[model samples]
Target: MAQSYATDLLHLIQGPPGTGKTLMLAHLAQLLAQDGLRVFVTALTHRAIHNALNKIPQVDANLPVCKIGEERLTGDLNVPNFETFDQSHFAEKSGGDVVGATPFALQSQRLANVEFDVVLFDEVSQITLPLAIMGMLAGSKYIFIGDENQLPPVTTFSETEAAQTSIFAYLAGRGQETMLNITYRLNDVLTDWPSRTFYKGELKASDEAASRRLNLSPEATRWDFVLDPDSPAVFLDLCHTNTTVRSRIEAEVVSELVLSLLMRDVAPQEIGVVVPYRAQSRLIRSLLRRILMDDEVNKKLVVDTVERMQGQEREVILVSFATASQKFAAQMADFLFQPQRLNVAVTRPRSKLILVGSHHMLKADEIVPEHKETMDMLRDLDRQLPDHHPAQRGYQRVKATRKQIANYYRLLISIMLK
Candidate 1:
């Protein structure tokens, strides 16, 4: 159970990987519904908001959910009072009702004009400031939830010193109060090392701190782990398997080993092997088929990318990252170390993470290099955003601005970065 705290009308809830931010929002809505308060739950993506609002039906079967917009969505899963901005011309169908949309979508004369009691923003860091502010304007009480440590906004200004954790900190300074020291994503055993590495600078490291940050029991255990039956474990893993295109002998051996694992009873969904590049995903898929044909092992196995597995979990996950290009490897290295994104991939597994396929690819020089040029670039762009962002900046502009910048600078940042 969560220890309750006092929150102002405007609430900002932030926790690490495993803290139940989504569930908290749902329960809060349920409580308000009990009081006969009409609650408007919203967020950056209409699809994501639909996921949240649809939870209403399971609780209250009669609650109507209507999707209005370009997505051409409507029906039972749609929140009756909800609307998506970028979807088909369902705005006419809305008939004066407020709907969910990206910040830029809501900036129009129509969507932004609606009113409501509570507006919620999830994955708040992914969007930009202008939209956050605009969304805040659409509702009386705005609730923003995010995990800054997992992934900062992918923007040119991302290297800005404030990009990592102060996302909600900025809002708190601007009258958007925060719900501090709560987490839903990670448990103790899993978050301990990262907590010591990532957050130890400002605060002392302990299970309490880890629990609060990760939102799990101190005794909680993690399932994902990378091991070479013949080698030591790698902590920050971007494991990949190759089926055809291979230059090095080690890469070949790794591919063979991955094939060997699939021959076992592990269901295709039980193990997720992700290679960031399309060439890699394709090569592995093709090779997997060929290997099954030639080998005596049972031919049951599966492979896919991280984006395809969002909001889904497995029993085991083996993520493969190829770093043939030194620069590409460096980018992959950053993706692996990024606490926010790292959380997303690792937490997808309920049992174990067998990170195979990258000892030669992501050598020290191949990953997050300490180059003066890049650091200088990061420091320069860091100042573009407000230290104290506007309280109501919607996720659209903030996230969009970040994406635009990230793409300009980190063109090679793809797969997981995308």
Candidate 2:
């Protein structure tokens, strides 16, 4: 479909998490450039622009690709910047066949007179209509690629106005977009719920990815219940409560998990900790710094919010939902249980995903009426578990006690082994 290009055509590709949208964009850009059409690529952020262009060389090594922006903006990607070319060269229409930039960078004087045969926009769901129009003016044909279920454009406008102004939200389910059906990052076990709840069960895992497991050795057996290689998705039920944004108990548990992974010889770079609140993230990082004490190791592990984890993957991802108080959770229900935020946080792991939180808090019946739909969706995950699963029984037995949680973990390991 990408090979057959025409003028004034607008195509949308809806790619869910881990579905390789950036790779498809790279191939499309290379193919158009080979056919003598100037291709321009832009996204909402510099990291996204770099991610799309970095894959072009893998498709075809000789394609002349140029990235627009300063060196500080584009990280570690080996692509030529617009500043390398003289103003007269671009004015003569003799610049690189493919150029990449953000919508803001597309407005620079250097590319003011430049135009392209095709313009591809990545992460369009996070882009508003006005920003999209800025890039649309630079080309005659267009291809928009993103997942509306991941993250919507951050805006101060009302939800109604935001939806009307978002191109992806407006045109997503109206039968105009092509859906990528296969994900290579998540195993089948980890892919099940999000696929059913968000993608209408259209997404499936590749055979190799479906069978993939964490390659932990016997030395890691201490954490086998939480990091079970056989089970790709594990939820540690820490039935504790936190009335505020920061939970010291959750931070301590996260640090212990990181230390355990490191002791088992997992590369620090292969582990990531994603939290919903910045205060929680800061608390976890501080605990890790004091425990690990090595600046190099500390820098290698990524500890950040869900927004920063988009377009990046790790072998193992630990999600910390720090608020377990019913009142506090209800107050922030819209942000905490937003489908897009939950989806992005869970789908970031390539091998294992560990979700640590109080299921009871999220399962409360008194949640705000507007967020009840999302709360029910989470409840469905618990309902689907086998009657004998630890998450089902542990919630009642642990009673917010650490010792009981540890006892519950031992029982879970026995069942898993049998």
Candidate 3:
């Protein structure tokens, strides 16, 4: 589909995470340029623009790519070529076969005279309808590449405002939409549940990906509890009240898990710690620092929220589902459980995904039938998974003493105060 030059006019590429969408964008632009067509590429942010251009080999010889923006804004890239919309040289350099910029940059008056035969929008799901239409004005045809199932554009306007839809979502029904089905980043065991739960079982793990092994040696199994064949994803059901979404016991467990991985020779760079809330991320970071103490280990591991781990991947991912409880299940069910957020969180791991949360909290009876897909997946996984918990139970639950609870509370307060 990347090399196809069909007459459909508008092309939609539904590239899920780990499908190499950025690489395809660069190669498609090269194909269009070689066909003697003027091509232009733009994304929602400068970092995305840099990411696409960085993937093109011998960028200067293969494509007449020019970065369009202010020198200060695009200076960090250190590209061989650049053009500013406000500069005098823009008129001459802008006529190149391909130009890269943001939607706002393309709105410049200097580009009013320029036109493109094809314009490619990367991450089109994040581009608002107005901004997407603004880009189409300068191009006769276009290609949109993104995952509408992921995050959408941040729009201040309501849905009542003239048909609320992102460019990618709007064209999904009207144009040719292609979904990339094979993922190269996740292992076979890691891909099955997510594919059936989130993507309607259309996604499959590539043969090469299924055969891929972790960087750790075979002896590392002693510390890697997730290596069990029956259960690649472990759910630790900890008991907690809904009063605080943050969990001290969760932090303690995650910290211990990270330390074990470190001791087992798993490089810190290969592990990622993700929490549902910012407070949990902060708390876990503090606990990890206290557990590791070494500056090098601290530099390698990542602790963040699900929102921040959108396009990132790690060999092993540990998720903290903060604020899970049965008493407040009805009140907090809708607020805490989001299908897309859960999809993003679980799919970030290549080999293993360990989720730590309250099973009762996650499987709250208050959750509407429609919104229980993620929790259902977890429940199904838990049932099929053999009892691999070290404690001889199917899952582990945190049992904190009165003093330990007090210390955990104080630690949270101290971190907040700092």
Candidate 4:
């Protein structure tokens, strides 16, 4: 289908989590460039642009890709930086078979006279309609690749309104998309709920991904319950004392958990700690720095907010919800319980995902009014069946609202940890 529609003016590919979207885009760009088309690649962020461009060489070692960005911002990508070349020098010396930049950067004088035959937009879900238009103008043909189920572009306005809808979502609503069905990152256990809830059960793990497990030896750790490789998803109900933006107890547990993973021979880079608030990220990072002591080891461990964790994956992802206060959770429900944020957080782990938070607080009754419908649906699903085991109740809720509950992450966690 992709080949048949390769020349379409607007092409959309809905790539769910861990589905090798970047690699697919890279290969497509390579094929287009090989066919003598001038291909331009872009995204909302420099990291995303570099991620897509870095893979082009994997397909062909000698592919000449020009990266347009400040030298410092374009991390170790093997491509030549456009900044180092004068306008005439670039046009003359480099044929510009493939060029990469952010939509904002494409407006630079360096690219004023440049045009592309094809424009590949990576992470298009994070590109607003206006930005998407800017990118579309860069070329005659376009390929948009991203997951609408993940984070949209960050905006100060209310995201619920149609004004802020991303181009990917806008086009996807019109049925102009081809869904990528298989994920290469998550295991079957890790993939289950996200597949059912977000993709209408169409998303699935590839054979290798379905059978993959963490490399850690379960017998090597005393906290095997938390470290069990066989259990891909573990929710640690750390019902700690009240807190607002940051929880010291949660930070302590995260530090200890990192220590255990390190003892089990997990590389520092293989682990990531994601938090909702900057304060919590700082607290966890400080604790990790203190425990690891070595600056080199501490630098490798990524402790960041969900916004920064997009387009990244790790062997083990530890998410700290950091607030145990129901009042605070309710007050921040619009941000905390947003389905896109939760989906990005949980899907970052390739082997295991450990979520630590106060399940009771997350299940607070005083939710944002927008999410009230999701909770009501969960209740309706609960009443449709006779009393049963806790797991069965959770399964029923998941089945009932698989497609409608956009904000069901909070209630889903509550049901799972019950």
Candidate 5:
């Protein structure tokens, strides 16, 4: 629409959260689809891009962009992470053509001679350096679309220090991005909450990278931040064992909870649950089935991974943080510091956020780092949840034996045994 015509080589779109970034990407992808381009579009998580693409009639009717990732979705071939993408198979299938993939996943499949007229990366901020560069290198017409204001690159301990050394550098070498100014969501005052208090918004307020971002007005005075006052919080306390629970097992939990809370005011469809990882994809599928039983429930509750739901709004979201700390839970577990992940969890729920934790641990940012500060703050914060939360909880001490009994008998029996 800008008549800016994205170069087949590389185009980067940077904007605020509510901007139609994903929509624009899908529109371009639809054009590519109509042209009979073997366009393969993918997101960092199955939940993020797949649904948006699947919703488009072009995708649903014609060239459905297959989701090729760790969790195999529709039209996707069974591929693991970047660790095992077969370059030969990619070349053979793609024929030096178009495919969309997560930056890392594209790298894993180190596709040789694979080319595209238009290659797009939606939500590029979530992409790390190595993966982004790899994908950019493979495609002649590369489009990297993401709001740097929303989330930065999520780097693991494995990645190098310099962000520029990675894919972003390659794009910058190409020179200048065409910015999208309008926001699709946040019509009037609702814009302010996300604009000012949102991730980059807060950063901007502090005068750090403030000039780069567009500021929005605040809504506290104009609109009630809480939409529904009478709406009681729907708390679905998920056990940590939720990840490992068989899909059928998880489905049963959803079913029981729905019936148990049926008399309550909230509709089954309104209830949303967000699991920890892609590993819980099966569990979500099962739970979704249970929630949809009422046919009247139009808007599906069972959802995709956390990354997809980032900055998204839902009626009520049950969150399983997916144990941040593997060992014993501590301050870092609270996830207060890591605003990206926290933002994903917090914003999903419209009225309430039902958080189920293995341990009520605090995120590092939740606690004071310095000795004197820790000594002073721990007096207040440490008192909230206990030190020996494991032992005090009683489940940790007996979980092994309890699980064994559950396997022998139905877990319902194991609950009675407990």
Candidate 6:
């Protein structure tokens, strides 16, 4: 990896999700610094840039790194960007080991004289070609780290203003890219459908043996939140509503399952709630708040749209696919049809994944022909239902173990009596 600097003028690292791209970036920066080269690491957003910077050790300890742009949302790191800092403050450490910033920050007049030996771009697919070109001008050589299959640059408004392909995508087509082969996030069972459907069966799990089967813990294996202990990926076939109001049934079921996990000694922070739309996230959050009164529990229970859940992971993930009804399928299809969105949602769970939505909507040809991959993946999950689970053609059972069953009814009875 360190030899990338001497190998090519422009190198592309095309890695799939959970392929340790960020960790690779950090190590590359360290190697470049060790070789006495000036390096700059960048991404499109402040959060992304900050994340890359956070991977490096303290500047004083090893590399002298500066972060530029808006203050980080978390304020976890106090390092200011070159453009934000006083000219003299940056000048002191200006020629130091490495720097992290957004492309816009690199264009600043303050950094015009600050040349870099190598520029590393994280999430390069999110960067447009023009911005990438401008950033490249500051360095003699460059490296791009991104997964085009996961999410492409957001260029809805600049359809005609800018070319659709990212710089990474453009270079990759010419065969100037290296693929990161190992994936640390998913086991083989969870990765099978995505591999064949998205990457044409090219994606490989880091653990060949573990990838061969779903490795649920003893508690999770017996946890009947859904049927089939061997199935890490599941589809909970709920009725999708056409109204603007959220699906109450989905919300109730999510609540019950989340509570069940909590009752079973699962940490709240290890669980996540993924929904297709912002409206559904809001409704689910509200429902969770009412049931989980503790602020800590509410804070740890992440209920958000899939876009927001990207670059994040949890031990357990519950996805809410609220798109149902033929009339609403058009609107819902707009949000759910994209293969990238589904990829992001499905891959975020490390241990277990549960998808809740109407199976009819998932398999409907009338919804959107372009979304066949998304539909196919959903159907593959639905096919995992065993005969013993028992449901209609389109409806799959959400199973729970004996203990969960006992606690569920016990809680229900207590509430009724109260």
Candidate 5, 114-228: lDDT as tens digits: 4555567766666666666566565556667765534455555322243333344346435657666555433222232344444334311122221121122232211111112
TM-score of each: 0.60, 0.88, 0.79, 0.86, 0.51, 0.84
Name the TM-score of candidate 3.
0.79
Clashing pairs in 4: none
Q: How good is model 2 by TM-score?
A: 0.88
- Top-scoring candidate (TM-score): 2
Predicted structure 3: lDDT = 0.69
As for model 3, its CA RMSD to the true structure in angstroms is 5.5
- Which digits, one per residue and each the tens of the lDDT, describe model 1 over residues 15-63? 4444556666666665555544444555555555666666555665543
lDDT (Cα atoms) of all candidates against the true structure:
0.45, 0.78, 0.69, 0.75, 0.44, 0.69
Model 6 per-residue lDDT tens digits across residues 334-373 = 4565667778888887767888766556545555576565
lDDT of 4 by residue, 1-418 (tens): 3641365777788899999888899888878877777888989888888889888988887666878777888675777786632532545644447888877766777577577889999988789999999888888988889998888888886647533478887888655678889999998767876886678989999999877788984445435557767566666666664787899867877777787798888899999999999999999888777667789999899999998899899999999889788777767766776777878998998888887776555554455565665434323322332232233221121121222222333433343355
Model 1: per-residue Cα lDDT at residue 140: 66
Off by over 4 Å in 6: 58-61, 72-90, 93-96, 109-112, 157-163, 208-223, 227-229, 243-245, 367-374, 384-418
Ten contiguous residues with the weakest lDDT in model 2: 391-400
Pairs with backbone N, CA or C atoms under 3 Å apart (clashes), candidate 6: 67-81, 68-81, 188-211, 224-399, 224-400, 224-401, 225-399, 225-400, 226-399
Candidate of highest lDDT: 2
- The lowest-lDDT stretch of 10 consecutive residues in candidate 1 is 391-400
Candidate 3 residue 201 Cα shift, in angstroms, is 1.7
Question: Comparing 2 and 3 by TM-score, which wins?
Answer: 2
**Between prediction 1 and prediction 6, which has the larger lDDT?**
6
